[model samples]
Target: MNPFVDIILRSCTVYFFMVLALRVFGKRELSQLNSADIVLILLISNSVQNAMVGSNTSLEGGILAALALFVINYLFKRWINQSKTVKDWVLSKPQVLIHNGNVEFKTLAKLGITSEELDEAIREHGVESHKNVKLAMFEIDGNISIISGDNNLKQTHHKRKIHKTLNEL
Candidate 1:
């Protein structure tokens, strides 16, 4: 085998194994990541290094592995976009943790989120209390979205006040 071709083949094999491992492990939201998740990601790179370079430790091997990874990621993105079911399977739907100012304890528990964690999330959003919130969603991407009950009322009042001021002017 030509030296360059051998490098390419090895790189491709490493890329394939990495992608397969990632798919099998499933998706995890950034905010939802624990210590174990971080360790697994770190280990993946270390484990694949030998397979990618092997006895052919060269700059070209590293470049080829990076290129193969990019190509695989691009194809995966396109596949997810082309099918809604695939998208759902790859990226889960957002879970509603709070609705009508009531905490969905069951949902939160299922997500492995504790009450303290929920409170911290809400506090990070600058919300004083759950009652002040209309809807609080835990997005699939692991971010919290808090929709305040007062926001609608404030908007309505602001519009009315603007109209009154315009009339007076």
Candidate 2:
């Protein structure tokens, strides 16, 4: 096989594997980037670089690999947008964590979210307590979206860049 073609194939394989891995790992991994998460991402990228380009470390080879990844990514996004079945298969539906001031404990447990984390997210949204929340959703993109039943009907998306312990907050 031509080296450029090989590079393209390898890059495409890595891209799909990454998408599958992220889907299997849960979308929460997308929202928060703790120290360990950053480290893992960095290491994974480094480890996959060789697999993508193989022994051909020339600039053209590297660019071809990146071009392949970009093309596949664009195609994937287009396909997902065009096909409901593909979108559903690739992404999870948002989960309701709180409704009408009631905490959805089962949903929290299923999503591996702790009470403290929920409380933190609520506080982040400026809601004094979960009782004031009209609806809290665990979004498919790994964001905790809070809608308050307060007079203003405020809504907030809790997209945390880094995980913080309760004590640290």
Q: Pick the candidate with the highest TM-score.
A: 2
Model 1 RMSD in angstroms? 11.8
Specify the poorest-scoring 10-residue window by lDDT in model 1.
154-163
Give per-residue CA lDDT, model 1, range 80-113, as digits (tens): 8999988866677888888988999999887676
Instruction: Give the least accurate 10-residue stretch of model 2, judged by summed lDDT.
Output: 160-169
For model 2, how does the per-residue alpha-carbon lDDT over 44-162 read when each residue is reduced to its tens digit? 99999999999999999998998999999999999999999999999889999999999999999998888988998999888999999989998877789998877764566787454
Give the winner by lDDT.
Answer: 2
The alpha-carbon deviation from the true structure for residue 15 of candidate 1, after best TM-score superposition, in angstroms, is: 4.6
Off by over 4 Å in 2: 161-169
The models' CA-based lDDT, in order, is 0.68, 0.87
Q: What is the lDDT of residue 77 in candidate 2?
A: 98
Model 2 per-residue lDDT at 34: 67
User: TM-score for every candidate vs. truth?
Assistant: 0.73, 0.89
TM for candidate 2 is 0.89
